[model samples]
Target: MNDDPRRIHCDRHGAQRPAFVCGHLVSGVGLGFVEPEGPQDEDASDEQAAWCDRCETARLAGGGWTAQSEAAAGITLVCAVCFEASRARNTHWMEGVARGWRHTDAR
Candidate 1:
């Protein structure tokens, strides 16, 4: 009865024999097991950016990338990889909004 949250022990037939903790299946084979990695540091520069819901990598808005809409309703800043992935996942949309810009209408 292991108490670890990341570790998983399965049976010989890959039937998910049920262990002490929840597990994420790695390969389709039943001869191996895997432990999930820890969360990334939120303050890290690489971590600061979100994985483009479309490309699955960090989005660089100025680096030949564009903003796209997500099926979840709202915009998801994404890269080329994620853009394609998001399209495949059917979880994203395309729309534009102002970011980091100030409006003089308030004055």
Candidate 2:
């Protein structure tokens, strides 16, 4: 198995399967390590920022950046890319507290 913790989970999919790990391990699939923001650890979240080939490509297509929520993880590690994608999109798995795209009931 790959020893790289970064290579374990797909940013798009959560703990599941159907994920791909590049042999060379030389791709921009990873958005980078998510360092918690705020004054203390209580306000921290999203520890990992890795993505799969498909999701990574999509993210790049979506301007190469997304947003994050407050309930990510202190060390959100990806275990596998299951058939089902993450509850939230990869674009929402950003580091600091998400700024744009607020959930509203206006149409």
Which candidate number would show the highest lDDT if scored against the true structure? 2
Show where candidate 2 strays beyond 4 Å. Answer: 1-46, 65-107
Candidate 2 local accuracy as lDDT?
A: 0.35
Worst 10 residues of 1 by lDDT: 20-29
lDDT of 2 by residue, 7-76 (tens): 5545554333333222212223333322223454454333423434444454456663345311221213
Q: Model 1: runs farther than 4 Å from truth?
A: 1-72, 91-107
lDDT of 1 at 90: 36
Clashes of each: 11, 8
Put down candidate 1 lDDT per residue, 1-107, tens digits, no spaces. Answer: 74643333333322221221101111112212211235644652331122222332212233422354222212323333433333333322221112233435866
TM-score of each: 0.17, 0.22
TM-score of 1: 0.17
